[model samples]
Target: MKYAVLIGDGMADYPIEKLGGKTILQAARTPAMDYIAAHGKAGYAKTIPEGFHPGSDVANMSILGYDPAVYYSGRAPLEAASMGVTLAPDDVAFRCNLVTIEHGRIKDYSAGHISSEEAKILIETLDAELGTDELSFYPGVSYRHLMVARKNLGAETECTPPHDITGKKIDKYLPRGKDGAFFSDRIKASMIVLELHPVNLKRIEEGKNPANSIWVWGQGHAPKFTPFQELYGKTGAVISAVDLLKGIGVYAGLDVIEVEGATGYLDTNYEGKVNAAIEALKTKDLVFIHVEAPDEAGHEGSIDKKLKAVEDFDSRIVAPILKHAQTSDEPFTILILPDHPTPISVKTHTQDPIPFAIYRTDNKESDEVQTFDEDSVKKGSLGLVKASDLIGMLVKAK
Candidate 1:
C-alpha cells in the first residue's frame, strides 16, 4: 500500500460577505478535493491542541503524528534543522524576519516578499554590523531568516510575530520581558543598517515595501524526534518551499525534496511539486506535499487571490496526484487538509479544527459529504478526531 498527504497550508477560512457569505474554500472550485470527499471518508481534525498557539509549527507536527506538547521546541529550531544550522545545548534559534515598518505600524510582515538574492545581502550586512561572539545571522529563503544566540536565554520573553500585527501599531507589540531590552536594541540597530542599504533604497524607488528592520521571534533550542519510518514502519518523504516545513521533515527523519521553482507563494511551481510527489511515491511508502500559496494569499488579505490559489491547488496539484494514485496497480490512500485557518476576516491563523478527507482506492465505502469545505465535512461519518490519529488511521489500515 502507498500513502500521500497534501496540505494546502492555511486554506481554511471563515465566511465572507464579499463572496456572498461563502468562505474561500467554499467559494473556490475544487472538483478534485470534492471528489475525494464524496468518494471517501471526511471529518474535522483538531490540529492545534488546547493551550497551544495556532502556529504552523505546532499544527504540522500534529499532522505528522507527533504530539506538539512533547516534540515542538520552537518554530525556528525546526527551520534551523532544515537549514543545517546546528544548535548547541545552550543556543537559542530565532526566526529573524526582514520586515517593513512605516508610520510606527507593522506595514508588511514579509517586506513585500523580498527576493532571496536581495535578502541574503541584507542579512550578511547585518551580521557584519551587529553580529558578535554571542549572536549571529543566517539567511534562508526571502524574509524568513535565522539568528542564533549562544546563550541559554529563557523563553519567557514575549515576542509577537510580525505577520500577526499587520496594519497595527507595533509599539505595543514590541518584545517585552527580561531579555526585551537587548532584543529591542538589536532590532533598532538593524534598521539603521538596512534603511539606507541599496536594496531598501531600490525597493523604495520602485514603490515596493522596503525591508528596513529585522524582527526576531519564535526562538527555541534543538528538538529530537523518532524518524517517521521508525514510528510508523514506512518510508516517508516531505516536499515544501518554506524552511519550517522542511525543518519538520528533517527532524522526522524524512527525505526533504527541493523542487527547482517551488516558492512559498501564489506563483510557486505547482506542477513541479505534483510531479515530485508522484515520483517520490514510486519508492516511498508515504509522501507529504505542502502548498503555501493559499496561506500567503490569506496573509495578504486578498480574497480573489486566495480563491484563485485554492482552485489552482485543486486542479494543478490535487487532480494530478489523485489521478496517479487511482491508476497505480497498488492500493493507495490519499489525505488532504490544511494545517490551520488563515481566516480572511482577521488576516491570521486561528485555532479552529480543520476539515480533512481520506480516499482509499481499494475501499468502496464512503460518507455522504460531497464537498471539501469547512461546513460540508461536518456531516461526514469519520467525525472529529485528533490530528495525531490521522497517520495511525492511514498506515495501520494498510
Candidate 2:
C-alpha cells in the first residue's frame, strides 16, 4: 500500500479562545472537516518535544515519521538551501528579517511589509554595501534573509528577536562577550545605516514597498540530519508553496516539487497545490504536503482567514485524497494532522501535542474516537505517539 501524509503547518496551536477565544476549527463552519473528526477516530498526538519551542521544521519532521532527536538541524540552513547559498563549515547563519528599528524600538519587523519587487532591489543595494569576503547577506522572501559569516569568531552572539509574540521581534541582542558585543554593535550600526539609505528613502517617497532596514534573528550554522532517502527509502517528494519547506525537502533528499503560482498568502490556489501534490504521489512513494496559509492567517490573529484556510485544506487537498481512495480499490494509508499548535491566542506556535487521525487499509472500521484536539486525542488507544513511530503504524498496515 502507498502512503499519503497531510500536514498543516502550525495549525493546532490556537485554542478556541486563543484566537480571540475561538479556534479556527470552531470558528469556521467546516462541515467536511467536522464530519471527518466525527466519523473517524481522533485524539491528541504527542508530536512535539515537551516544553520546547515549536517550529514548522521540527513539527513537520516529526510528522513525516522522523525522530526529531535523531534527525535535527538548525532551521536557517534548511532555508538557506532554498536561496542556493551554501554555508561554510565555519560560518554562522541566521534566519533574518528586514525590520524597521525606529527610536530604539521595533516599529515594523517585516521591513515595512516589503513586496518581492522592492525586496530584490533592496538586496541589490545591501549587496553593494554589506557584501564582504566573510559576511554575506542573501535575501529570501519578504522580510526573510540569511546572515552568514565566519563561525567561532564573533558568531556566538545573541539577537533581539521577537521570539515570542509579545516580545518585539527586535528588542536587543545579547552578546556572549566583548567580541560578540562588538559584532552585534557593528551589525546593528550597519542596519541603522541601511535604514537611512537613499534608495529606501526614494521608495518611501514613491509609495513603493520599502524595506529600508534590517534585523537579525534565529541564527545558527550547518547541522547534520539523517537524509530522507537514506531513512525513508527514497520514494518521497515535498510539495509546498513556501520556499523554506521546499528547501528542507531538497536538503533531506526528498524530491522537491513546486506548484504553479503557489504564493504564500491567501490568494494562493489551495486546490492547485493539493492537485500538484497528488500528481507527484503517482510518481513517488511518499509525499509531504505542507500548507502555510493556515499558519499565516493564525499568526495575524485573523480568525476568519484561519478558518477559511482550514476549510480550504479539507475541501481541497484532504477531500481529493479521500476521494481518490474511495473511487479506487488501490490500498493507501493517509494521515492528517498539524505540525504544531498555532493557537490564535497569541498568534504564535505553541508546544502542544496536536490532534490527528489515521486511516489504514486493514482496519474494519475507524476507531470510536471523536473530535480532534489536545484533549480529544488523548482518549484514543494509541496515546501520545512520537512522530518517528507514525511510519510504523502506517507501513505495517495491511
Using TM-score as the measure, which candidate wins?
Answer: 1
Kindly list the per-residue Cα lDDT of model 1 for residues 165-234, writing each as its tens digit: 9989877888889788888889999989999999999999999999999999998889989888888999
TM-score of each: 0.99, 0.87
Per-candidate Cα RMSD to the true structure, in Å, reads 0.9, 3.1
TM-score of model 2 (CA atoms): 0.87
lDDT of each: 0.92, 0.67
Spell out the clash pairs found in candidate 1: none
Candidate 2: tens digits of C-alpha lDDT, residues 236-332: 8887776668767777778887777666666666777777777876877777777877887777666777878887877887778777755546666
